[model samples]
Target: MKMSDKKEILNSDKAPEPVGLYPHARRVGNLLFLSGVGPRKRGSKEIPGVTLDHLGNIAAYDIEAQCHSVFENVRHVLEASGSSWDKLVDVTVFLTNMQDDFKTYNEVYARYFKDNQPCRTTVEVNALPTPIAIELKCIAVVDG
Candidate 1:
């Protein structure tokens, strides 16, 4: 592919920095692919709804709060790429305790996507890069 056709990184000061080397999202053609977004706030170590021990182990958490933050962060990345929640086509959700958290997470998710609901998949994972209980990775279709 031509260099101009290569993917472009997307970043937003309103969103938390990536936990690793990857960008917040990448644009390839008309699609924007977002990285996993956690509940940690921008420029801070705070993870909403999560209480961490001295050693950074999760002591307790509120799935509703974390879910809100994660979805808002995803929105920031999407807007940074000139897209919006309505443009989202698919989303992959990761939960540390799916059996216990799915109901609450789904409730919050429904509030956000009341009209433009996208295809979604929720999976249970042992853990994430941070102590937060939830993360979201999404894909959006953007107009040229």
Candidate 2:
């Protein structure tokens, strides 16, 4: 394989920079591994579509908005590595409240991955960065 065949690393100015010690995604061979993305906007802690209720009940956040944020992050990762959603193979979603959020999550997820829904698994977790509800991670095939 020519040196040009080497994997490319991607970062999008529109997406949040990796907060810890990692890049948004890394290319190895023909695969792109995207790290978990949250509702927080890139380079900031502002949570889009988040709202609160005055009835002593936390008004539910917009699952679709969160989903869109995740997808945008995914898109940046894929493009950074010269890939697309079509090349995705698998996804894993970490939910702080799967029971209440799965339906909404699926609704938005279906919109982006309508044709070929990649293999995926959703699991409930104990905590997340903030009051945000869900996060998603993905692995995709970078077609040459």
Clashes of 1: 0
- Model 2: per-residue Cα lDDT over 66-126, one tens digit each: 8788788778777777788898999999887788888999888888899978999999998
lDDT at 89, model 2 = 90
lDDT of 1 at 90: 97
Choose the strongest candidate by lDDT. 1
Please estimate how well model 2 matches the true structure, expressed as its whole-model Cα lDDT.
0.79
Output the lDDT of residue 68, model 1.
90
* TM-score of model number 1: 0.94
Candidate 1, residues 87-139, lDDT tens digits: the string is 99999999999889999998999999999989999999998988889999899
Cα deviation at 73, candidate 2, in Å, is 1.6
Question: Model 1's lDDT to the true fold?
Answer: 0.90
What RMSD does each model have against the real structure?
1.7, 3.5
Clashes of each: 0, 1
